[model samples]
Target: MIDSHAHLYYEKFDEDRDQVVLRAREAGVVRVINIGTDVATSEKSLELAKRYMGFYATVGLHPTTKVVDLLRDIALLETLAKANPDRVVGVGEIGLDYYWKDVAPAAQKESLAAQLDLARRLGLPVVYHCRDALEDLFAFLQQERIQPPGVFHCFSGGPSDAERALALGYHVSFAGNVTYPGAVNLQAALQVVPVEKLLLETDCPFLAPQPVRGKRNEPAHVGHTRDFIAKSKGIDPGELERITEATTVSLFGLS
Candidate 1:
């Protein structure tokens, strides 16, 4: 299995980051993509990817933070990607985050557009981090003609949103949130997401799935999310795992 998305570089695992990777390997997680939310984290992600054989990284400046100099950060990301093409698989966790409201909506849109353009120019897939701004995100994608291959990480929209995303040739990734009892909308979206476009993620150390909810998440716990999604789609867990692993590998060009 592949974790598709995680932040193992986060400080949450500072004390035993190696142990976390070991646990993920023991748990049958073959690969993990440590996402970058800023320039510092992007560097850390690449370091971890180099340290671990099956680990990979994505470089981007998340829109949730105040990007003091968007152009500089974008240049930094480009430099990182160019320097480590093998380890840096994509450009992301970049998108609008209306839930935080710390950054202005206009700024978020601008950053997202620039990053999307960067991903296209880099010839890499994207890992989108959208929250409470799907409409505007879709609008920006349409207006900018940004149709790069990517995944809508931790998707929280309805079936229509999933349909639109699939129509746009973007895979929809679900995280631990999909296991929540109240995630009816996500469940509905999952039902419509064809197995070919389904991707599983942990989004750790953030949304831990049931049986371990409320705890710091890790790549090893991706199985719980996979099981939940399999049951929701009425398929065998192993089959779901196989399909998602293939989708992740193909999408990210994992070796």
Candidate 2:
């Protein structure tokens, strides 16, 4: 399995980060994409990617972050990403989020616009993060300012969102949240998305599967989500793994 989105650089794993990677390997999650939300963490992701085999990194400014100088910030992110072509695979975990309402909507859009333009200019795919702003998220996506073949990571939408994402030539990745008992809408959207267009992620340090709920998530717990998705779709677990793995690798160009 490939954990398509993870923040192994997070302080939560500071003590046991190496062990977490080993646990992921033991659980058969061979390839991981360490996502970036800010300039510092993005550099850390590149450093960690170099330190670990089968690990890749992404560079982007997440919506939650304060949007200072959009152009300068995005330019720095682009420089960091371009400096490590061998390590950087995508531009993301960047998108709109209205959940907190603290970060001004205009600021989020400004950052998102700059980053989306950066992704297009860099010729890299994007990994999106949306929260309580799918409506505006879809609006930005439809504008075609960003490149194609990005992913809506940790998708929190219904069947209509999945369909629209597919229409836009983007993928929808489900994290451990799909295993929640109350994720009826997510489950239904899962059914709507063809396995070929699907990707799986742990989004670790968050969204631990039901079996390990209320715990700090690690890449190892991704299997629980995978197994749950397989069972929910009534397909062979191995087959699901193969398909998701292929789709993830092809999308991210991960080795």
Please name the candidate that would achieve the greatest TM-score relative to the true structure.
1
**Model 1, 40: alpha-carbon shift in Å?**
0.7
* Candidate 1: Cα lDDT at 221: 98
In model 2, which runs have C-alpha deviations exceeding 4 angstroms? none
Superposition-based RMSD of candidate 1 using all C-alpha atoms, in angstroms: 1.0
Best candidate (score: lDDT): 1
> Which pairs clash in model 1?
none
Candidate 2 to truth, TM: 0.97
Q: Candidate 2: global Cα-lDDT? A: 0.89
For residue 126, give model 2's deviation from the true position in Å: 0.5
